[model samples]
Target: MLLLSRPMAPSNVVLLLIGLHGTGKSTFAKAATGQDVKVNPTGGVDAYTKECNKYTVDFKQRRFIIIDTPGMADQNTIEENLDVLQQVADQLQNLDQERVNGVIYFHSIEGARLSGVDRDNIRILKKICGDEFFPRVAFVTTRWDRIRRSEWDPILVPRNRDLETERMKLLPNGPSIFRFLNDGESHKAVLDYFAGLEDGTAANRGDKKARRSGTG
Candidate 1:
C-alpha cells in the first residue's frame, strides 16, 4: 500500500518476485540479491516454495530483501499454488506494507500466450494484492533469443496489447506497465528495470528510463 516516491536506500525495502516456473525468477533474484537463496518453509506464515526463494541485497546504505515465489505456471495443483500465493500475500501484509515495494512478473517469450494457468495465477495475485498491483508489476519476457523476429513480432504485438488491456482491466489504477525481452541483449534492460525500481523510478513509465537505466 506504500507507494515509494523515490527508490529508498536498499536497506529500507523488500521486493517480491512472482511468476511461473522456468520464467527466470531464480536467475533474476540471484542476480539482484547477490546472496545464497533461501526458501520459505512450506507450512510457515510465508509458505511459498518449491522454487520460491528469498534473498537480500544492500546498496547505498539500504537493504533490499526479495522474496521469489514459485512460478505459478509450473506443474502443480492450481489450488496448492494459489494457497502458497495467498500465504505470500498474507506475509506481505504482515510486513510493513511499505517495506514490500514491487513485484516482478515473469512471462516467457517461448510461451507468451497467457495460458489458463497464467490467467488463474494472475487472478489470484490480483485478488490478494489488489488491482493496482499490476502497475507495480513488470512483465519480463524470457527466452527472447529463441524467438525469431518473423514469428515473435506478430505474436508479441497482439499478446502485449492484450496483456496490457487485461492487466489494466484487472487493476485499473495499478502501478504502471513495463515490458522487457530476456536474452543476451536484454540483460541490461532487465537489470535497469529493477535498478530503476530500486531507485524509486517506475521502470514501466517509458522507454527512455528503460534504455538509460538497464544493465544490459
Candidate 2:
C-alpha cells in the first residue's frame, strides 16, 4: 500500500526476482511490465517458471528489466533446485549489465505458515545475492488483498512480524519490506524505491520509507 509518485530511475536498471513456487513472481513480473507477459494462469502448486526470463517496462522516463527466475517447488529434488540455480547463473553471466541493480523476492501471505521449502528457498536466495547485494534486496509479500480485515491483528500482524524477523536476519541494518497489493501503483512504489537508490536519495532514508510502506 505504499504510494510513490512516479520515479526518475536511471535507464536500463535490471532487477532479479526469486522465490518459491506460487509466491507471485510471475504476477509481479506482469505488473512491472504493465503487460500480460506469458505466465501460468492456474494458481496451483505446479511450477510455472522453469528458467530465467526477462521483461521490460518503460515508465517515468526509466527503463526496467525484470528477470524472473524459476522457483523451488515442493516436488523438486535437490538436483532440480541446483539446476534452477545454474539457470540463474547462466543468465547472470549473459546479462547486458555487469550486475543486477536490485532483487525483488516474493512471499505469499495467504499460506498459513512458512514451510521448510520456504526456508531453503530463502537460503538459496541469500547465496544467489550474497552479502554485498543485501542492501539492494527487497522482500515483497503478496496476497494481502486475499486476507480479510477481521484477521488483521490475529493473523496478518504475527505473520508480518515473523517475516520482518527473517528480513532482518538477511538485511539487518537496512530497510526492505514492501507489500504487493496486486496493483500497478503498488508495483510502481516498489520499483520507485529501487529507482530512488539509483538517484542517491533513498540510501539514508529507506528506513523511514520502508516503515511507511510496510503497514500492510
Among the numbered candidates, top lDDT falls to: 2
lDDT of each structure?
A: 0.56, 0.69
Clashes of 1: 17
Worst 10 residues of 2 by lDDT: 1-10
Off by over 4 Å in 2: 1-10, 75-79, 92-98, 203-216
Q: What CA RMSD would you report for each candidate? A: 6.4, 5.8
lDDT of 1 by residue, 68-110 (tens): 7655646557797777676665655555343456666776656
Q: What is the lDDT, from 0 to 100, of the residue 116 in candidate 2?
A: 67
Clashing pairs in 2: none
TM-score of 2: 0.79
Question: Can you tell me which runs of candidate 1 are displaced by over 4 Å?
Answer: 1-10, 34-51, 58-62, 74-78, 86-99, 132-134, 148-158, 175-177, 180-216
